[model samples]
Target: MPKLRVVSYNVRGLKDDRAALGEVIRDLAPDVLFAQEAPRRFRWRHKCAELARSGGMLYASGGLPGLGNAILVSMRVTVEEAWGLRYPLTPGRHLRGAAFARCSVAKVPFLAVGTHLATDDTERPAQAALLAATIREAGGTTIFGGDINETEGGSAWRTLADTRTDAGATNQTPTFSVTNPSRRIDALFADKTCTVTSYSVIDTPAVRRASDHFPIYAEITL
Candidate 1:
């Protein structure tokens, strides 16, 4: 089995240090980057392209329609199919969504999804359920990553954990409030068919300045 390095990050809509963020991502050298809070306004694609280029990657999927969710892949991966999905809006609440891609690394295929759930306690569960269904429909080996906004054992977290392997189960490193770090809201989940070899919370200086949430990195095999 080949090992793939995957990272999930919330870039805070590129509102922070872009150069620092790129450097952190480049240094991490992930095969697949599942990003949330990416640029979604005017020239969003251009911004995303520039970020990907800076990190030695190419845009895979998700941007505007995903409401900030996006995915970037290294040269080693070929994106076979990709699309963005918008979750049903809860009037007056922020729009949340997900990005999905079927990619091949050295001709071995798998599904990757990125999302950011709503902050509302009541709304996040439904979003999680929707995300879980999307993963189930992804077929083959699947991996999902995002800023879930809820802690372990929470409803939204439990919804996904019930059917998938929580990548951070072995390493409960905190990933929120970069400076004061006190929670593990950012996470990665993979289908049982895939093996999560290692998982870590990237809390380096660059990562702390890149966004409000520390990135989660995982080494997986299918």
Candidate 2:
């Protein structure tokens, strides 16, 4: 089976150490990037395009209208279809959304989704439920990545993990507070049909300085 390298990152709206971020992403050479906190304000499309081009990739979808969630794909993958979705907004809370791409690498197809859930404890569970339903409807070997904003034993986490494999469930590497990490809030989940070959929390110096949260990487076979 062919392996697909995927990365999930929270770039903090590309507001910090963008150069280092670009370098780290380039070095990782991910086939697909599930980016959270992507630029969503003025000239967001231009910024997303520039970031993708700088990282030697093409803008696949998401961002702006997707409430800052975005996807970038390397040329090795062929995107069959792509779309963005906004979660129902909760009054007075941050707007959340997700991006979906049905893609193929070496002719093997899978559905990928990128998202960021609300930081509010009460809000996250509902959001996770909606996200899981969306994934169920996506159909195919499904892969999801995001800043879940909740950790192990949390309702939101459990909701998503109920049917999918949480890549970090056993490893439990912290991926937040880049300088002195102590939380495992970011993660990747995949359908059982997909094999999770390897997973890691990227913690190199460049990655630490790139954003408030470290990137999580995974290798999956379909």
Candidate 3:
């Protein structure tokens, strides 16, 4: 079995917090990384790709030119295909989307998703469903990491539980809002077919200082 290390981060780029994000990725050395809030700051600013390369990884991101998600993987992994999930305006912010990369690590196939959902109460459930649907469409039993901006006991959790083919909940940890640091807006969720051997919140302060949110990590085996 391959020891799959994954990370979910909301790097508040296109803003003041883009500086410290790269160091966090280097320190964690995750095999697969999913990032949100990758807004375009300039025409040539490839923050996501640059961060991935700095961490010795490859990256593919771009849905609506900017304001989407990104998936980064180490050189050891092979990415088959990747795309973004564009949600509707009712429950989505239109430009807000989830990015996916169908990848193989050590001969094991898994799908990675980078996502962000609307903060509105009614739209979040629909957005959650979209994520699960994306996972199912990817053939199930994959690793999902992102800044969901929802707590474990919220409606989004209930919605995900209903849509998931697997049996498990969020890590029940906190990851977000570094300025105050009290809620868990970031998370890692895996399919029922995957087994989570370990999980933790990364304490890379330099990384934390780069954005308003921190990163969540998990060690999964299948």
Q: List per-prediction Cα lDDT, in the order shown.
A: 0.88, 0.88, 0.70
RMSD (CA, Å), candidate 1 to true, equals 1.0
TM-scores vs. true structure, each candidate: 0.97, 0.96, 0.86
lDDT of 1 by residue, 166-205 (tens): 9999788898888788989988988888899998888788
The best candidate in terms of lDDT: 1
Of the candidates numbered 1 and 3, which has the greater lDDT value? 1
Off by over 4 Å in 3: 17-19, 40-45, 62-67, 91-94, 162-171
For 49-119, candidate 3 gives per-residue lDDT tens digits of 67677666678554343246778787777888777777777633445768887888788887777778877
What is the alpha-carbon lDDT of model 2 when measured against the actual structure?
A: 0.88
Q: Please identify which of the two predictions, 2 or 3, would achieve the higher lDDT against the true structure.
A: 2
Report the lDDT tens digits of candidate 2 across residue range 7-57.
999999888888899998999999999999997879999999988987788
